[model samples]
Target: MPLFEYRCMKCNHDFEELVAATGRTKVVCPNCGATSVEKLHSVFAARADASPIPVPAGGGCGRCGDPAGPCGM
Candidate 1:
């Protein structure tokens, strides 16, 4: 099962749902009972055992000599 986020256009309510593969396309908003619910992409948190990742900023760090922060140049 996967969790998906949905926002209702009619009532402007946001909610999440745990659904199977077949139920992903046919979800309805529970708050407003409207079929105009828009499904949103779900974001998952990184696991504890995951590798240390580099930050994705454009500039480099001036204080630490690292690419973690923005370089003023």
Candidate 2:
């Protein structure tokens, strides 16, 4: 089963669902118990075990303006 993201139109709640296959499938919102929901573009996260995350060139730390911050530029 593949996990997919969805947003409830009735209550405006966002959730994830384990879908069988890609198609017009009915999904219920767990928060609002509404059947009216819309599929959303899922953003997946990856585990970088010991590997350094690449930082864009010249674009100082995204958070603090310091270049030598935790998010090294």
Candidate 3:
């Protein structure tokens, strides 16, 4: 299954739904119960680097509670 983003053209409502990849699925707006919808481009995350982003001294590394961050124990 894949998640899809849709906007209701009739009601202007935004919502997400999980659908089967094999066939066409009917999408309906939860807000107004309308079948008129437009699929929106989905955005995804990709790591540019393996290392965690660095935080300056005294700025806590949110993950490990370190004041200076390189994310290493």
TM, every model: 0.54, 0.51, 0.55
Model 2: CA > 4 A from native: 22-25, 45-73
Better-scoring candidate (TM-score), 2 or 3: 3
Q: Candidate 1: how many backbone clashes?
A: 0
Tens digit of per-residue lDDT, candidate 1, span 1-73: 7777889989989988777876436677888789888777663422322533334456565545576564433
What is candidate 1's TM-score against the reference? 0.54
Winner on TM-score between 1 and 3 is 3
Question: If the candidates were sorted by their lDDT against the true structure, best first, what order would they fall in?
Answer: 3, 2, 1
Which residue pairs in candidate 3 have backbone atoms (N, alpha carbon, C) closer than 3 angstroms, thus clashing?
A: none
How much lDDT does each candidate structure score? 0.67, 0.72, 0.74
On lDDT, the candidate that comes out on top is 3
Q: How do all the candidates rank in terms of TM-score, highest first?
A: 3, 1, 2
Model 2: what TM-score?
0.51
Q: List the residue pairs that clash in candidate 1.
A: none
Q: What would the per-residue lDDT of candidate 3 be over residues 1-73, giving only the tens digit for each residue?
A: 6677889999799998887878988989999999999988452222324455766667767667776555653
